[model samples]
Target: MNLFPINAGNLKLDGGAMFGVVPKSLWQKTNPADANNMIDIATRCLLIEDGNRLILIDNGMGDKQSEKFFSYYHLWGNHTLDGSLKAHGFHRDDITDVFLTHLHFDHCGGSVQWNTNKTGYEPAFKNAHFWSNKDHWLWATQPNRREKASFLKENIIPLEESGQLKFTSLPENDLQNNSELGFDIFFASGHTDKQMIPLVKYKGKTIAFMADLLPTAGHLPLPYIMGYDTRPLLTLNEKEKFLNLAADNNYYLFLEHDANNEIITVKKTEKGVRLDTVYTTEEIFN
Candidate 1:
């Protein structure tokens, strides 16, 4: 199996929103904010090439949205999803599966795109089976008022409408030792309902795709939760449990949102689990 870090794109988000109630004074030390108080954010998706199956985890926000719509997020960067795939000698059509950690626009928006005619929306990866758990699918489709803005219809409905959507079976508990996708899934609901965090095995190490559950190295602290999370208290509990497990097992965390830190490991310190070492995708994957 080969792992590739696919850079869909990069954007800037409000540091306050990203770090929740955590004071900027502390967060800025790690994720320094710009004059506008926006911090760098990356839509760093993962590509799993195992045999003939080319699985992509979380495509970034596609270019289909209007300029006015995108202005809110302050999208920037030269990394296009198609360009990234081409760099790896692949294309969207070659993707057999698109494993979405969640349906948030930044995470799964690129799953669908505008058709050539510009008449309607269609699955971005026409040949790929888009993956999302049943619970998350429902939660996103029928989004609550708080999360409604993040779950855009154009970014989501087309996958199901195109008949390419598939749901992963949830485990009885939060952690699924084995999933149909051939990896362990850590189901976290604090960020959003049933956000599936895939634990991929590679190079004798487990790489946990730290989606919104742990957006960046700065978020390693238990209290540094995202304000966007529906249940902040529940997030604290979930992060404590997951961080301890990651530290104990020496898992390499593949960060999805951190623009600067690509991969990292944690150690159990007196202050609880803290960042141990940071690594680029090249350092680890190569």
Candidate 2:
């Protein structure tokens, strides 16, 4: 199996929101904020090429939203999803599966796009089967007031409308071994209900798609949860368990929202599991 890091785009978000109650004095050391208190974020998707099945995990926020809608996020970057796919000698149409970690606008928005006539929305990848679990599908479709803004109908409804939506089998516990997508899935709910974190076996190592469970290296600290998470206490427990597992097993965390750090490894330190080493995509994938 071959894997590639797909750069969808970059944007900036309020550091306070990203790091929750963590003081700026602390988070800023690792994720330094700009003058506007906005920290850099990347929609880094992952592409898995295993024979005929080309699976894409979380295809960034698409370009369909209005300028006014995007302005709030302060989008900035040259890395278009199309350009990144082409750079790796592929296209959206080549994707067979779109494994969404969650239905947040940034993670799954690129799954659907405006049709040619611009009359209505349609599946962006004509040939790909969009993947989400029953729990997450229900949570996103019937979003609570706290997460309503992040779960946009335009970004989600079209996949089901196109008759290409599929659901992975939900795990009895938090972790599902060897899912339909051929990888273990770590189900996390603190960030959002049933956010599936893919644990992929690549090149003799486990590469975890650290969705919002661990957005950036700065979030390694257990208490450094995102303010967006609905259940911050649950997140603390989940992160503690997962981080210890990752550290003990020596997993390479593939960070999706970290613009600066691509992949990171954590070790069991005296304080706790702290960042051990950082690696660029080239260093690992190549």
Candidate 3:
């Protein structure tokens, strides 16, 4: 199997929200904020090519939202889903599976696009099967007030409408060892309901796709959790468990929302699990 880092684009979000209750003085050192108090965020996705199946994990926010809607998030950078795929000698249509960690706009928005004639939306990857767990699929489509804004209907409905939506039927306990679409799946609920984190085995290493559970190196410290999470206390417990396992097993964490740091490995330290080394995707995958 071959892996590639697909950088969809960069966005700017409030540093306070991203860092939660962590004081600015601490987090600012690693993820410094701009004059507007916003920090750079990357919608970095992953491409897994095994056999004839090309799987894309989270396609990032697509370019279909209104200008006013986009102004709120402050999208930046020249990186795009199509451009990034082309850079790696692939195209959107080549993706055979789109494994969405969750259906948040930044994560799955690129799964659908405006159809020709601009009358309606359609699956962005016409030939790909869009994957989301049943629980997350329902949670996103019938979103609660707390997460409604993040789960845009336009980004999700098209998958089911296009007859390409498929749900994973793993039992709760089976998540840890279950492999699907060429990845070992693990589920976490702190960030969102049934968020599937994929563990891909490549090059004699277990690479954990740290989707929201541990957004960046700065979040390695137990208390540095995102404010956007619905249940912060649950997140704390989940992070503790996952980080300990990651450090103990020497898993390389592939960060999705961290703009600067690409891949990080954690080590058990006097201060608990902390970052050991950081590497770009090329350094690790290439």
Candidate 4:
């Protein structure tokens, strides 16, 4: 099995929204904001090459949205989904599975693209099966008022329309065991309903894809939850349990939104679970 870090572009988001109630005095040190108070974030995706399957976990925000739409997020950087794939000697057509941690635009937007004729949309990964659990699929499709903005129809509906959408057959509360994709999925609800965090066993270490649950190493503390979460209180409880489990097992956390830090390890400290060491994929795997 081979794992690759795919750079899917970068964007800026309000630091206040990203850090929730955590004071700017605290989060700003780790993720220093610019004059507009927006911090740089990476739409970092993961690529898994195992035997016949090449699976991509979260393809990042795509370029299909209008300039006005992207302006809100302050999109920046030259990294793109297609360009990143080509850099690794691969292409969108080579992906056999797209394991979405959740249906948020930044995570799944790249899953679909505008067709050649520009008449309609189509699955971006022509040969891939897009993965989302039944609960998350339902939650995203029938989104509540709070999360409605994040779940865009243009980024989602096309996958189902193209007949490439598939749901993990796991039970609602199941947070253990691997899905058919060969990675154990932990269901987290605090961030959004049934956000599946893949626990991948690779090269004698467990790599947890920290999709929004733990956006960056700065978010390691229990109270550093995102304000965008539908249920902030629920997030606290879920994060506590997950971080402890991660620290106890010595898991390598693959961060999705962190621009500077790629992978992080946590250890139980007097204050709580804290960042232990940082590593590049090459540094850790080598």
Per-residue CA lDDT of model 2 for 1-286, tens digit only, reads: 9999999999999999999999999999999999999999999999999989999999999999999989999999799899999999998999999999999999988998888999999999999999998999999999999999999999988888899999999998989985478999999999999999999998899999999999999999999999999999999999999999999999999999999999999999889999999999889888
Better of 1 and 2 by lDDT: 2
TM-scores for every candidate against the unseen true structure: 0.98, 0.99, 0.98, 0.97
In terms of lDDT, which candidate is stronger, 2 or 3? 2
Report residue 238 deviation for candidate 1 (angstroms).
0.8
Model 1 lDDT tens row, 1-286: 9999999999999999999988999999999999999999999999999988999999999889999988988888799899999999998999999999999999998998878999999898988999898888999999999999999999988888888989888889989976468899999999999998999999899999999999999999999999999999999999999999999999999999999999999999899999999999999999
What RMSD, rounded to one decimal, does every model reach? 0.8, 0.7, 1.1, 1.1
Count clashing residue pairs per candidate. Answer: 0, 0, 0, 0
Per-residue CA lDDT of candidate 4, range 45-64, in tens?
Answer: 99999999999999998888
Please report how far candidate 1 places residue 34 from its true position, in Å. Answer: 1.0
lDDT leaderboard ranking: 2, 1, 4, 3
Candidate 3 per-residue lDDT, tens place, 153-216, comes to 9999889888899987755472556456877887888889888889999989999998899888
- The best candidate in terms of lDDT: 2
Judging by TM-score, tell me the better candidate of 1 and 4: 1
User: What TM-score does structure 3 among the candidates reach?
Assistant: 0.98
Cα RMSD of predicted structure 1: 0.8
Candidate 3 or 1, higher TM-score: 1
lDDT of 1 at 110: 90
